[model samples]
Target: MSLPLPATGTKRADRHWWQTACIYQIYPASFKDSNGDGFGDLPGIISKIDHLKSLGVNAVWLSPCYESPNVDGGYDISNYRKIDPRYGTVADIELLIRSLDEVNIRLIMDLVVNHTSDQHEWFRESRSSKTNAKRDWYIWRKGKSITIGNECVRTPPNNWKSQFQGSAWEYDAHTDEYYLHLFAAQQPDLN
Candidate 1:
């Protein structure tokens, strides 16, 4: 798509268009269901563009609709470049963007770069071994061994608590190390 031209006679110091845009946030799963599949999809969102226009929405802040395990309400993204089948396909997203653009509405997709699903290829390879090329892509640390009830137990590297409760680090038996997750263990923190 071509870059939007700046408004005529608008000074650089002036507030940008987005500074005053009326953005409407949409969580696809709970917004509208187009196929009766019990989940909202991109097509369903497209079907409501008229309603959004009537509501004077100048932009849409779409929540993550990327391929995910839905462990944290689709925040555990398994793939960053692909759309989840539960929502729709890449074409659907393209159409949505184009449709929104046609009506002078901007599309803002929510991207979660802080962490990725443990099922993601990057995380999988990172946890494969300490020497894996992508290993440094995530935060991994050795745990402190403590004696507990006659048996040696490995505790998290630090006393950091996860937002979802419990230790923020999850021990990986394969690599004999712990990976940090600020949220759920399924969503490992990316370095």
Candidate 2:
């Protein structure tokens, strides 16, 4: 029922640093707000570096801070390569990395690739028309309405439920199809 532990003597030092390092997770939006903007930015995290160092932390893991609609608290990313304006600029992130490195703190980012914001460029192009170049980038399916006791019932492609709420698929009026979203309607699963 239990897995065997690594050799405790000589093998202890051979293990990766992550096996023993204390990693701290920070949700940037709620961590610290710089510039009185009421939203956390890379600079805000940089300002707290001393606290992390004093806490004996080795690495810092951050949730998604990419450009997004924030429909799912920044998980619905609109752009993967750009930082959200509310979070600061790419230069600021570089500064944060350098600052963390000065204190021996590794920076880790949460990569949310299961799905993306419906407003993402690729999603927009995909939904623009069925013949679009990126139309196959996202899941799209036809749905049917079932008649039960005289009442017509329209449902998603399947009975899959969304983690956020309601059905896992949202009907696109323009595309005349339903797209799968494991979380919120704003986040459509990639094909």
Candidate 3:
């Protein structure tokens, strides 16, 4: 089933720029590495503004480059406000934005909010204790306990599976609870 296209000769101002923009996705880790660190960084991206413009790119969707433990390829961000040191600093990102703006190219960041790195301050506090002030920020449950052969064992909160495979819940011995993780064990789902 084909959808009807917009009427020809429609005024450009009548539609959102994104409706007809040429967007390019850049995985900063694999893009140009300006520092020779073997990983792409913001400065590297900034250095390619001319290349992006020459490619007729109107927008760039940058993958996550937030501070993380790299357990989930930066998707498990430890800090949402800070850029990973390996990728450069916040100032570098600001420069990248301005550079892209110079070429009329928009910048879109891949912000992962559904879950955060286990090392994230919020997640760390949430997992510290059941009564932690931020405990409710993440999904936690007391999994069922089963007796097997004379030993008692705790199982996951449920039989749900993770997208990356195995159980979706990780057992926290400190809190004696199972936290939900849709992706990696290090990434717990936000409440």
Best by TM-score: 3
> lDDT tens digits, residues 86-168, model 2?
98999998899999999999999899989999989999999999999999899999988899999997778999999988999
User: What lDDT does each candidate get?
Assistant: 0.95, 0.92, 0.93
Best by lDDT: 1
> Residue by residue across 33-100, what tens digits does model 3's lDDT show?
99887999899999999999999999999999999999988999999999999999999999999889
Displacement of the residue 21 alpha carbon in candidate 2, Å: 1.0
Candidate 3 vs. truth: CA RMSD? 2.8
Backbone clash numbers for all candidates listed: 0, 0, 0
* Predicted candidate 1, C-alpha RMSD: 5.0
Runs in model 2 deviating more than 4 A are 1-10, 148-153
How do all models score by TM-score? 0.91, 0.91, 0.92
Point out where model 1 deviates above 4 Å: 1-13, 148-150
Residue 103: error of model 3 in Å?
1.2
